[model samples]
Target: MDYRNESSDTLRNKCAACYRQFNKKEHLVEHMRTSYHSVHEPMCGVCKKHCRSFESLREHLIGPLPKAECERIFKERGCDICLSILGNRTSLRAHRESCLSRPNNNGLLYRMANLGIQDELRIDNSRGRVVALACKMVGGGSDGSLDLCARVCLIDEHERILFHSYIKPNIPVTNYRYEMTGIRPEYLRDAMPLKNVSRKIQEFLCNGEPIWQIRSKGGRSRILVGHGLDHDLKCLEMDYPAIKMRDTAKYPPLMKTSKLSNSLKYLTRAYLGYDIQSGVQDPYEDCVATMKLYMRMKLSQFHKKENYPLATDPQNKNNFASWRQNELERMTPDQLLDISRSDYYCWCLDSQDY
Candidate 1:
């Protein structure tokens, strides 16, 4: 089935969704089978090309060898951050102004813990909600090589402080990371113990449901949003099911063009249009940043309506049936794309369930 025997000028088999050329038609078919390119994928605003992720879309728009015409159009009207195409120069200017503006969450939203309270978060019993968690770490052990969670903060979807506490590490702290964390020796001297903080966080996140119940999907486990949650959770000596965790650093749409995780500061500026972690790191600020990011992603409304019976759906496994190979081979790339589905679940889908 090799097409290398054919002339170079002859039409080469190519994937309609990603535009990857194939030497054989069967290879293209196999690619469509595994790629699952659906309408839900991130697409270029200029050319209407579907990409595997936002990173891929960015590459298409502004990478080393972008589509010349598309790049020209995008350079004029495309939003560098969200990659949206605006109507005109004025609209693009206004859109960029608003798009890059930093969100203003009033300081009054903070509900600080009273000095008399012991290991208490003032959040009410409206369970099964989405919350963002962020923890600031201090250096522990000799030469400050080990990370210890010294502060943790949680905020509900509305950016209200649900839980915020300074944790006293089980081990002695060697570096409070004063310049970045602004945590002093006194903050940990009489702060809440790690065990108590861990228990309260676990209880709050689980919403009084047992681990098994939450794991079974029968319980209302609050969705945990964060950046680099694995590091935070590891430092805190706690574990949460992956299904309930939404790490902005790991979410495809918010990643770097290189497919690497972007730092919170970079993501905040690029996507959220604000700068964070500029000087001293605040867990509450991180919580708000992460929550804002989560909300923005969840509120995405621009993606085309999901196709029914997605290519990844079990029943749609035989997307290009062998019996219809002749018909599929004759179809154009755009036609093939119409029958494809996204390989990964879009985060916007979370809005529907939540």
Candidate 2:
């Protein structure tokens, strides 16, 4: 009686590994060999279906011809920014309210008012100065070959905004990427020119001291913090000393099991106990998230204080070859764990106090 189900079950070949269906058994075998679909593959947030790649996953969720059932549900409950399908309409509405709200000067005003400081905040002669920066991109050409910096924001350690501005691109914009970037052509039409923006950012980052002076002194220049800072800096045509940069994307603890860096959305949700970039990408939101992540890592209890200035210390070299055989054998497991190890020289080691 159930001929349709019986016939389909008998005819269709499925991979037990990834639940992918194939018309023929040999095809399934071939797919298993080449596809290598595993738990590590990116999965659809709505359907939990494994995609061959992130591009495939994007197509499944938001392409012209998505799965009808998943598309319907996603339309009602999914966040366009992070592409996550939340539980219900009420929850999604609450999330959208927070996600869509623009960051304002209220937080900065409160901090300044509380401190009772009328003078301008300056980074000059300051120690352990940290500033979070974020940038928004607009399409550069008709073929989407390039991205230009359209907006930038800077926030201090206290979540106080220092600078926020829109930058006009030199090249004509083919796409505003409004759905994610929340930038419009009108916003950039009368914005600051690229040259001016670059100069201003350089001044702020350098804090009145020359690059060489800051590199030698290590106190005048502010530590730049953000996610995917290389891309942002590339778009802005600006550069900072790598020693003074803290990029959350490349941080080891936040990476995937496969050793690939995690997305900011996932990192924020996992560590900060909330979601961001849900409806539109906000530079301010991103800055705050990155700053918070940096602070959290800095304040981690596992951090060893003995490894201060880990970059400059030649003795801190963790290579096993450098260690004496007797010393290595004599070391306890706990002492072995105490040996300073990092994916990259952590900038946290540069700060005397966080």
Candidate 3:
């Protein structure tokens, strides 16, 4: 009479919800929710942390998940897929681009996270020269295409570096000519934005006394510099009169009678005996080249404005001044470009204080 079914005497080791074997109380409890109703699953409601299943989770759970904290962390960190919630959007975008590498495909999202909000120019008034420099290490293709963030070195005219920022771009423009300029996209993923460029520049320009002091001082009536000066002035949108600027491009004697070669490469080689090469022409170099060329051509002013024979080159030094006086006036633009490439001899003349 006391006898019972052998199966009943045995402990029910298997779980009723999922039919899974569970020897311990905890296992059974955990599996119950996993195999039972979906609502009881252990899941982070806010961050969507999934669990085994709703039912098992409900029964086995000890404490509720702090979804707010999770959400806060999520927002603090940049989400590559969802940029809005990410803390470091630039990094997130960079990861996304690396994830999807393609031609014509710039790292746009990264740029937005890093671009400088204010892109105004800075001028220093006390230094009597523009001091601020916008240094950017951009990444991407070429043709001024900027996609990634890179190191931007902010320096002053006195060789003092002011600010170094890691900026991102607001707009996505791939440096189309990246190869020509040697800019690597992978390198600029964490650089500063162009927004702060103007602010720094304005700060530098303002600290200086003023620009155009040479014109104000009545020196040369105009500043005779080199070819790329236009681009330099254009960058900051500062204007100077044509007479105030003596572009080597506009000179003719340098091109024809110098016999020094029309190209800056050959001219620099012949005059300065140095090679002129750069991954890309920088505004700083542009200013230097223009200054040098302007100084080298000062002798032309002493010329008598006539055309000399091709044979009357540097070899005929005795007749050089007179010959140039006769020939320098009739030279072409290409010729001037050649002469402007030489060492600035105007320093010698200016030394005489004439």
Candidate 4:
């Protein structure tokens, strides 16, 4: 125990492939047995820590127990969500300027109302109805309390702007989060109150139908689409039926290989070949991105119709999990391919007729 002559490599059993040091040889052997570690594993941008996966990288950067020094610097120069370090105060300032201010016509509500359209959203009856929702948050307190919704936008499947408004929060705004939200005190001074915005959004989403009616009687309710929708909806003080939600953040196929959800910006770039949320966040752009992502998943041919509710039904868990070794071996390649293997219920299951 007193010996200081051991080589560093021997003291820390480092895996050859991943270069991760384990305290014991047995742990390194166990890691290798899974065949999970590789050189391709994501590395932290700042610390250069080789993570086992993107999820590990995310936890390293932003999770509860992040590296203290990295977290401190990250708070000053890094994007909390994307984990991108902006490098120096000047660069971060420039990034903030572009990030918060999207190029669009000013006076969102006035422009939408004066277009000679009805107050209610005009849903296209022919195509499957989908509506995208986005919300901007204003800071609550210095203690990182819940942010209030300061703005909201809703768009249709046809990319039509249905509703947009600056919402006055119920509580006083402690942090405008101007760099990300692009909201100023003057903007909210004359903005519509939270109650009015909530009422309008409810009317738009429900399409003049009661919530109960939509659930029980198969009434028409526009499919709600967005990224991190639950958070947005919570901030907006709004609710929608769970089954009708098509969230880019929760969709299984769009998730990371580790089964962790990818950021909306990342997903947009990967799937749609475009960048978004690069600077001041625009709700309209967010709506469009979510809508596009939702449509892409809904129209995917990867999901076979025959799989149906079986992928989600808890009752079938035993049947699927307890497949005999002999039974699996006996299956033809085509038969094995036919086996349902989705991580989540397909959104298309509700959107289209099988």
Return the top candidate by TM-score.
Answer: 1
Q: Report RMSD for candidate 4.
A: 12.0
TM per model?
0.83, 0.61, 0.32, 0.61
lDDT of 4 at 123: 33
Q: What is the lDDT of candidate 2?
A: 0.66
| Candidate lDDT values, in order | 0.75, 0.66, 0.36, 0.64
Better of 1 and 3 by TM-score: 1
Sorting all predicted structures by lDDT, with the top scorer first, yields 1, 2, 4, 3
The best candidate in terms of lDDT: 1
Q: Model 4, stretches more than 4 Å misplaced?
A: 1-128, 143-145, 213-218, 257-259, 300-303, 307-309, 313-318, 321-337, 341-343
| Per-residue lDDT of model 2, residues 73-108, tens digit only | 888898654456789999898876644423344534
How well does candidate 4 match the true structure in TM-score terms? 0.61
Candidate 2 segments exceeding 4 Å error: 1-128, 257-259, 307-312, 322-343, 347-354
Decoy 2 TM-score against native = 0.61
Model 3 scores a C-alpha lDDT of 0.36
Question: Which tens-of-lDDT digit does each residue in 238-277 have in candidate 1?
Answer: 8788878889988866777436888888878877777877
lDDT of 1 at 152: 86
